[model samples]
Target: MKKNISLAILAIVLLVLPLLFQSRYTQHILNMILIYVMLGISVNLIFGYIGALTLGQAAFFGIGAYTAAIISTKLGLSFLPCVLCSAVMGCLAGFIIGIPTLRLKGPYFAIATIGLNNIICIIFLNWEHLTGGAVGISGIPYASILGLQFDTERKVYFLLLVSVFLIFLLYRNMISSHYGKVMIAVRDNELAASAMGIDTAKVKVIVLAISTTIAAIAGAYYAHITNYVAPDAFPVMESITFLIIIVLGGAGFKYGPIYGAVVVVILNEYLQYFEQFNMLIYGVLIMILLLFLPSGIAGIVEIAKAKYYEKKKIYYLKEVGIDEMK
Candidate 1:
């Protein structure tokens, strides 16, 4: 009952957030929060569930963005089709990268992904005709549905909101299914899962593809909403941010990404005032949080809940003792 109520309240807040924050800047920040939440969820699918530390998420993210930008500008494709194509591109990239690379474990896998991102960045820089090089692509069309154009931030907020909700449903359903269990098994113990006939390699590849697809979808929306796609936008730092989101939210938990997104986005916003010290402050806070609450914000909540139940049990025992004494 409490969980349901909390969800209901969150839903209501999301629905009315745009109206409450009428400023364009605030709306833009909120939209970014939505985007980061999608990215966080995607990262969680691999990093949390499958135990893969991917640094090439921004590569797929850039691929999706560039895909949307090129198709929309050159082919004159509409929003939905562009999004689909971008997701396909991201999935293909994931497949190609994961085939030989997924076999590498631990730091080796992570290093390979970092290398992949660098290679992709170089490609984006050199492939001037396709990706517009360092100058970047611009003037992407606004997303539209049934003749309704999402041009303004307010309108874009609704579009992104629906997209995020749909993706959340898809993610929730995916994680709740048997496949999710297999992924978790792979994360916990790959050799054991393989011994159990789980096909660990295949599971990792599929989950990686799915995670890239989700990130691409967000990239697609970002291209349309921002009307631009720059290679610099999808840097390794952005990928790091995605990882941080999962870590701060307590990876492996279902709602961890969302919690992480809220905290990260709000922190970023507040730290803007610090300017030069923003990163320093950010690092300090992260260090403190990890040092004290290593399990993250979600873990704190879990600990509190456990303590509450313990107190309640003790109080009940005391009451029983009093009755017996009487």
Candidate 2:
């Protein structure tokens, strides 16, 4: 009951959040935060849950963005179809890349993903006839669903909010189910999981596919919301940034993406003023955060909750004279 009430309150707050912010720029920032949150979740799945450090997620993201851009601009499809196609392409890319890449372990796997990101970026850069190459695709129509258009920042916020919420709920449910336990098992000990009859390979591939699918979905959203798609936007550095969001937020924790996205986006916005020192400062800040909070912000929350419950249990035991008996 409390959980339900909390969810309701959160939903209410999100719905009214746009109205409170009169600045379109501020609203746009909020939308970007949500987009990054989705991306963070995608990374968290493969890295946090499956224990695969991927640096190629941006490739799938680019694939989705370009898929939406090409479909919507050239084929004149609506937003829904474009998004669907983008998802399909992302999943296909995930499978094609994941099959061989996932077989490698640790740093090797990570390196392969980096190569994958570079290859995808190259394709986006050289494929001018299909992807518009370095120039990119523009004039993407505003997203519409069943005749309702999302043309304004405020309207787009709602669309993204709903999408994020739905995805969050689905993610939560998946992690709570039996399959979620299987993922945890694989993460903890791949060899042991395999010995126990779990198809560890298959699990990793599926998780990768799921992760890429979400990233692509986020890419589609980005393409439509910004009315443009560019090859430069999905570089290898962007993939690193996505990984940073997961690490900074708290990988494997439910609200890690939300906490990480808000902090990273806000920090990035402020860092823009530094110009030449932007990356230097960003690197220093991340190092500081990792040093102090190795498990990230979500880890702090989890520790607080654990301590609270421990104290509560101690107090209850004392009240029942258990402490005195001891």
TM-score of each: 0.93, 0.97
Candidate 1 — worst ten consecutive residues by lDDT sum?
317-326
CA lDDT, every prediction? 0.90, 0.93
Q: Which residue pairs show collisions in model 1? A: none
Cand. 2 Cα-lDDT:
0.93
Candidate 1, residues 1-326: lDDT per residue as tens digits?
Answer: 99999999988988899999879999998898899889989999999999999988888888888899999999999999999999999999889999899999998998998899888988988899998999889999999888899999999998999999999999999999999899999999999999999889999999999999999988999999999988899888788888888889988878888899989998999999999999999889878877886777788888898899877777887877743321
Model 2 per-residue lDDT tens digits across residues 1-326: 99999989988998999999999999999999999999999999999999999988899999999999999999999999999999999998889999988999999999999998999999999988999989999999999999999999999999999899888888989888999999999999999999999999999999999999999999999999999999999998999899889888998888888999999999999999999999999989878988888898899999999999888888999988788522
TM-score, model 2 to reference: 0.97
